[model samples]
Target: MHDDRFQLPADADERTLLTCFLDWHRKALVRTCAGLPDEQLRRRAVPTSNLTLLGLVRHLAGVERWYFQGGIAENYPGSLYTATGKLGEDFDDLDSATGEASFAIWRAEVETSRRITAERPLEALSTHVITGQSLSLRWVLNHMIDEYARHNGHADLIREAIDGQVGE
Candidate 1:
């Protein structure tokens, strides 16, 4: 009920608005998981789904690295998870997942992403790791906002199922 996300400004530059909205959504995802037990955080509340709050964190950690570090910075080492040719490992492998470590990795990756964004202008371009096509920082930022917005919705539902907690 007490939100700690960045308050979006009524008037701001494009970069500020994009980054602020992205950060707000990023915090919203973490807020969805706050104060929950590790086991509860890993619960697949949805029937026939592997989606979990911890998995979403893990997935977003990799996503941050993939988009900002890899796509924009062009220095992708590899996935934070899914290295064993096991796709969806981030969401499926939660047998031993811990909230502390997962959140830490997610935060670290997000910090790196902020740094990457700070170094470039909106018009700055980089190649997409998959499509091998050029993209601007602005595009990447918008994509990240979309990515987090979609996943945050999932997190909210999963959290609600876990403990009946719900909010923006």
Candidate 2:
């Protein structure tokens, strides 16, 4: 039996490895809402702002885009505002015009980031646009993995409350 995971090396540096893990988990996170009831997708299951599961999915998509495409991949050419100039408030929009616009922005970012990862080797380092520091492909990959894992935990509680589905 074999277990397949995204981490490149068993003894790899935490930042590098976690980036891949985060990417996988984020993928899983987005998939969490797949095929769910539209009303449920639009409903906020928790007490936070208006973060519906669908909203989270869109939000993460936006985040990945901004991070990979905007920051690392594109280096933030234009503006990076998801919601009223607040990045985290992205999910708070809850399918509003801002949400819809951000969703499109996020989707574009994800697609561009995916292309970047596919084309570039993980060993190659990408410079953070604002920081002017080089970040290895491996590093960002792990970062994304960790980010998704954390949020998915939040999603777990929300989804379970909405539909009794949990884990992963």
Give the number of the best model, judged by lDDT: 1
Q: Which stretches of model 1 miss by more than 4 angstroms?
A: 1-9, 84-86, 129-131
What is the alpha-carbon lDDT of model 2 when measured against the actual structure?
A: 0.64
Worst 10 residues of 1 by lDDT: 1-10
User: Across residues 1-168, which tens digit of lDDT does each residue of candidate 2 receive?
Assistant: 122354266787654455456556756665566556566767777676676666667667766765675546746664444536675665554544443454466567667777777776777767767667777777767667766777788777778888888645
Give all TM-scores, in the order shown.
0.92, 0.70
lDDT values of the candidates?
Answer: 0.89, 0.64
- Score residue 34 of candidate 1 by CA lDDT: 89
Clashing pairs in 1: none
